[model samples]
Target: MERGNRESLSSSPAAAASASSQAQPQPQPQPQGLFLYHERQRLQLCLLHALNNLFQDKDAFTRADLDTIARQLQLHHPPQQKDHKWWILPLPSLVFKPHHNALTGNYDVNVLIAALEGSTHQKKVIWHDRRTPAASIDLAACHLMGIMLNTSVPRLRGFWTSRHWTALRNIRGVWYNLDSDLPAPQPFRHETHLVSFLDNTVAQGGEIFLIFNQD
Candidate 1:
């Protein structure tokens, strides 16, 4: 993972990310069946995978592209500097910012918002606040593009935990769970089913970010 120019925070992070992600997106094929479910390896890159799945294109982004964004964000809004023991060398994890983990890729929601909003596709991220009722979100809305969900999963036989990114998007008139954990994209029966599914997910400590295109 190469770090971009670690010079100054005065420069815009979004501008840097735009240089790559804002390239005119090549036309992508629509996912039709099982064949489309076969996506590339997305190891520890659920944020990248969720973006590609939300946009329905494997080539939508790269780990490097997101990495640059992460770096820039860290540069602009760095965490509090701490004095380390003179004898101890600083670890990369210590320098890693909250927006993303430089080692293990557990990119947070801020990265998601930045990546999508910075891209040329003009997508907007609207976080459905936990205080609000899930049903209050009109599933029938015509402008809805998709939904990105962040779930916490236990790992190493429940010894540790990590965050996972997933998406709910409409394909061929059906809603599908484009979760990286799933072997195949699972389709929701209808809009109603999708709403209930989201409600349940919220109850279980999941966060939802609704996506839409700027008019």
Candidate 2:
């Protein structure tokens, strides 16, 4: 597969932001019958692009960094080398900052729930991860939380000074990546929405078929 090669795909960050703006209003209603499954592929491609943007950062692919990120993100199955031998096997992984998770970062659940809550009056749908310790999240998980939540971007830029740049330049950190074959992080599909839609369909004597692809 080629990297960043699609003409149909958005080429610039500005283009991506444009697509997001357009998609935000009047989110297309979930299709019915067989067509519902067809959207899965489209969703996956969007997800892959989103994850690429989320996890792209400066970091080394070291074991210690991977361990720390996995612990922070509550990721299961930390990376391991074949036969537990040192310097004998090459591992593949995605690297990112120590404080964030590749999937949704720290603020995913909270932001998602809040967004949904403001949009609808449905019952709250809880997120579950088998690898997570406690089953809840808050809003502080966003990397630049204060800038994103409390102030406008233009105002935030005004706060970045030479002192901040100097401090960042002095920091020393190794880059590490987590090796995994999992597909991209898909969009949050609220279970309540799914259940409610499916129930309404069944009441109408409509048929449903579930289609899935594992790569």
Candidate 3:
């Protein structure tokens, strides 16, 4: 997530918006009825969980789907344009693939982009500029699809760090936080609350992504 795939922003998370003319607001996402699909934390696969939550479908994405994307990305850009080898035992492709953690699922932004853009529904993902508030854009005009958030977290005795994945979705005019870390989906009292919550999240080492149906 550092910089291997141009998937992460090197600047502090506080500066989430590097380009923006004004402010904005995303769509309203909430469960339709008594059901909500969410995947809990397991094997460091928050990105996988977040994607499913954003789509509001348990089978929206799978670990294998993400794995294949990571490998393809690696194959397109190898350090030496050949398989990495040491002695006679071929090195694992994971060693060269930084798009994800391989065994678990620390998928980077590149993987996220590829996965969603590859979706059959023709959905798209774009990074939000936190410098501009959500209310700046006219997402309420029925354009936004969802929001995937990446927050920085400490790891390995607070020495190293990793990003956590979560998402806010708009389903039928309501907003819900489908964070896999949470026991259940959390609905926002109103769109204002949703905007405030997102601003605060990105204020401290986080990135916001706006998902849409098309360009």
Candidate 4:
């Protein structure tokens, strides 16, 4: 073959190899799991809306405070439980009324213990009165709903009441109130460190579920 022809043949191997490689199918990268852009955008928008609601009621929730709470809720990165439900983290310690706040003098530790044992919420409550024997109090229940001290965030006691009622009615369900407080109960002031409700669905590892506030 002529020198030019020989050179062409030599280069053809490289071109052929390239074309063959290109022709072979490459596995398309699996799209990163369920976190689609639209979903993320929707969540962001919802979060913003929630923040905006908080802002409009800034007196009830200061910017710094809201940001802090948002960060806490955002830190959770658990997988989604279902396509619809929101995720929430239960703070068992903070959910119940503190010992000092129960001034009704009906310090039935067993009542609190029973409530804890009976709690069916995602975050179960277990009262340990023996752990701190010095505290004189009864009626122990997880601080399912509490007010952030010095804040005007209203307590949806009625909402909790309804949830309790429903939870009590449904034995198969895993969500419920600790116990049914007796009527004509002792008067006790509300004092707690819980912030506003973030949408926290229990299915995913850690996601904020939807929060419903009446009023």
Candidate 5:
């Protein structure tokens, strides 16, 4: 009886150990591409939230507003890449210049619109003569001018090309060749929508900007 009791106790421990090991949750392995994709999605959400906060209670924004937004963005998501710089170029006015110490090279089109709309200084009228190929502008400049200027502006009728994609915002109130291959009269409900659209585009290897054109 004593030997039997000892054996049972020893077997009980082994059985309990086996059960405990089986009960413990195992970590599932994630593919490298999928993991990176999820991380990017999380980061994109953070950026969109920050932008939404920046636009609250404001109809139009200025360069100063962009500065504030940039600071918020940096605070929320610090630069992951070493010595990363963000460039801003306001077409036919200010050239590409580094504005922030972040890793992202893509521009934020919404911020560019806010900067241009809020500016008090009048931009000198420069018409883009169809006779001459409209000068190729950067992603930031193209979206900025497109959103801020009236469709009637002759200079605004040029085709703008970005690194990843080419799009035409409006040609005399007729939209054509828009980003995401979206159809004409794109459904732009609000600023948040615009930011979201840009975010999705950027994620899909599309070009963007975030700099405030001070000129």
Candidate 6:
């Protein structure tokens, strides 16, 4: 009986080890692509919400308005040559002014659209970009251009500078940087690299437009 009890104790540990191994949880595979897609969708929704909040009393935008803008942008393909001097779209009304407060950055898309649409060649009224931070103006410009061109504006990482509101176009998978003061569209690399370059420039107190590229 003692021998039998010893055998039982020895086998119990093996049984417990087996049970422990069986109860261990396996690592689940992460759905990275799905997560990214959902995140992009959420960002679009957030942009829409911000726009609604900004223009709720004014000419508010619906999802259809955004879709319409995106469709128009997709159809309007600008010239992609680096030597072309006339590549800059004439946004005469979208001028920039220095702001004393650095935090005055407008992130509302609806306000941007309204400003663009309501702009007249005669009046040339001062818009949000005039008072807002350069980074915010450039970001809004990129988003507006991206929607117009039916492209996905990739996420950017960089600080704001006092550069004027700038817009870049991605034509046939190539990037063309646009500045009103420049004579032509400047060719730049992808979004990540551009943001890194901007970050370095900002650290040195050099002003540059925050660049965004299509995915």
Q: Relative to the true structure, how large is the alpha-carbon lDDT of every model? A: 0.69, 0.24, 0.69, 0.21, 0.29, 0.31
Give the clash count for each candidate.
0, 9, 13, 23, 5, 2
Worst 10 residues of 3 by lDDT: 2-11
The C-alpha local distance difference test score for the whole of candidate 6 amounts to 0.31
Candidate 3's C-alpha runs over 4 A off are: 1-33, 79-96, 155-160
Q: What is the lDDT of residue 3 in candidate 4?
A: 7
Where does model 6 exceed 4 Å of error?
1-113, 116-144, 147-163, 190-192, 200-215
**Candidate 5 structure quality by residue, lDDT tens digits, 1-215:** 00000011011112212211233222233442210000011111222222222222112332345556555555566545444235633341222223332333223543334333444522222323323322232333542433221111111135543222222233333222222111112334444455455545445544433323235
TM-score: model 6 vs. ground truth: 0.24
Stronger candidate by TM-score (2 vs 5): 5
TM-score of every prediction relative to native = 0.77, 0.17, 0.73, 0.16, 0.21, 0.24
Those runs of model 2 whose alpha carbons end farther than 4 Å from true positions after fitting are 1-71, 74-77, 83-91, 95-195, 198-215
How many clashing pairs in candidate 5? 5
Better of 3 and 6 by TM-score: 3
By the lDDT metric, which is better: model 1 or model 2?
A: 1
Quote the RMSD, in angstroms, for model 3: 11.8
What's the CA RMSD of model 2 in angstroms?
20.7
Q: In the order shown, what is each candidate's alpha-carbon RMSD? A: 11.6, 20.7, 11.8, 28.1, 24.6, 23.6
Location of the lowest summed lDDT over 10 successive residues in candidate 4: 1-10
Q: Which wins on lDDT, candidate 4 or candidate 6?
A: 6
lDDT of 3 by residue, 87-204 (tens): 7554565353668876667889998888888856577778888788766755585668888899987665599887888888876677788776554567786888987788788788
Decide which is better by lDDT, 3 or 6.
3
Candidate 1 similarity to native, TM-score: 0.77
Best by TM-score: 1
Off-target runs (Cα >4 Å) in candidate 4 are 1-63, 85-215
For 2-90, candidate 6 gives per-residue lDDT tens digits of 00000110111222222112332222335432100000012223333323322222134444455545435434643243443576764
